[model samples]
Target: METPPKTDIAAALNRVLLTRKERLRSKNHWAGLAKIPTTTVLDAFKGSNSTIDTLTKLAEGAGMTLAELLAHGDPDWEVQVKIRNTFRSWTIEDVDGLIRLLERRSGPRDSDAS
Candidate 1:
């Protein structure tokens, strides 16, 4: 199959940074969290494209995958990405327990909610 269309990396990085500004705060903070160089973060803020490895670290620092970072324009998708990131290191049983607890708090799921 043909590869999916490439996102505009610079634009995507800008969007990610904007969406995460409250947490990331400054280029130095972002670089520290992503374990990348401050200059790289500055370049990204200026709309420069970054290497995949750099992008991956940046995405991780933002609590998301690279794909989620690139496709992060939607508000709902943003929530889902955050939830998925939060759950990434949990055991299946732990996740199931959380789901059950959430279900109890929220009441039964709607038939069409899924």
Candidate 2:
């Protein structure tokens, strides 16, 4: 299957901020959290194999919560389609709600914690 649209997937994963630079507010925020030089973070929105920790810091520095970071957006990635012989169910709607609910439940991350 074709990969989802880059924007769609990126937004869903909360990495859109890195690409758009909206997730970062100031140089000092990253400096205080990540040991990496401020320039490095700026250069690498595309951090290879980087974990959520880095993403969290980026979001925090930008004053956004992790859940805010990971939101798949209003279109909703969980809004998928399933077909059966004769019965039809709105699984996508339910799934989308669940994902959004989960996102809301996840609070912000600590800047100091390891």
Candidate 3:
């Protein structure tokens, strides 16, 4: 799948779960995933203080589609994934949503860690 543009990442997620509460309650949710919530992940983006491997693990655990998390939850689910390509140092293939998130967060342009 071709990777969607980066901008739509967050928007797709908004359309998806509506709130952190719902994402938490998802069928795929697991204790490993819940250990860190979306808000926590979002906040970590602010300072590049988070780890990518951790995020990917969470994403997989939560059953979040990869394309959804990678584009920051962009509208397009298609992924032209240059699998294992790290952006802004956010690449951790083994992990779940963690790598892509960290990549965006570490960058100066996407430091919206709120």
Best by lDDT: 1
Off by over 4 Å in 3: 1-4, 7-9, 19-32, 37-39, 42-50, 77-114
lDDT of each residue in 1-114, candidate 2, tens digit only: 996544332343334444335433344455455555566465444334445676576556545455554543325523321122112444787779978888788866578998
lDDT ranking from best to worst?
1, 2, 3
Q: How much lDDT does each candidate structure score?
A: 0.77, 0.49, 0.48
Number of the predicted model whose TM-score against the real structure is largest:
1
- Please report, as a residue range, the 10-residue window in candidate 1 with the lowest summed lDDT: 72-81
- Model 1 pairs in collision: none
The C-alpha RMSD of each candidate to the native structure, in angstroms, is: 7.5, 16.6, 15.9
Q: lDDT tens digits, residues 45-110, model 1?
A: 676767888888888987777878877644455675676678777999997998899989998768
Q: Which pairs clash in the backbone of model 2?
A: none
Question: Where does model 1 exceed 4 Å of error?
Answer: 1-5, 73-114
Q: What is the overall TM-score of model 3 with all chains considered together?
A: 0.33
TM-score of candidate 2 against the unseen true structure: 0.33
TM, every model: 0.55, 0.33, 0.33
lDDT score of residue 106 within candidate 1: 93
lDDT-superior candidate, 1 or 2? 1
